[model samples]
Target: MGRWVLHLPVALPRRVDAVVLVVALRDSLGHVPALDFGEATVSAEDDQSRRTRVWCDARLGGGQRCELPLAHDGGCR
Candidate 1:
């Protein structure tokens, strides 16, 4: 189990209905794991910076499931 704090910078259109943040995790076998984090909503007013906290569980059968120095993919929708 590990905790990660990410600071994200978001830019929104002048006129938009809604914005969302998406995060995805993959394991060593290129398999998507059961992630504890979900999509987060971003308001138009939140144009500057956003702070996100994530918890990851890399344990699998008493060993590490994912590769070392894990990389995360995050995007705004």
Candidate 2:
């Protein structure tokens, strides 16, 4: 199955900062089983090329998603 996309309007001007904020929010709300933090990504308006992934989001055993950063070295958790 494919993943869903959500566009959130943030007040920050920089993409890096926006990603940081997003990761922080996801981590703080980690207890929420409904939130898929691994699939989180940030992008400029209407720019698919600039779409930056905030997490690895790789599928693991036991139906779990990787919580590491995008393109992270080593193994997924």
lDDT of each: 0.37, 0.79
lDDT (tens digit, per residue) of candidate 1 on 1-77: 99775535456564232222233322232343444233233444554355332322345555444322223454221
Clashes of each: 0, 0
Give the per-residue lDDT digits (tens) of candidate 2, residues 1-77. 98666656676778889888987898698889777677676777667467678888888989888888888999998
Query: What is the Cα-based TM-score of model 1?
Result: 0.26
> Could you tell me the lDDT of residue 57 within candidate 2?
83
Q: Per-candidate TM vs. native?
A: 0.26, 0.74
Give the CA lDDT, 0 to 100, for residue 41 in model 2.
69
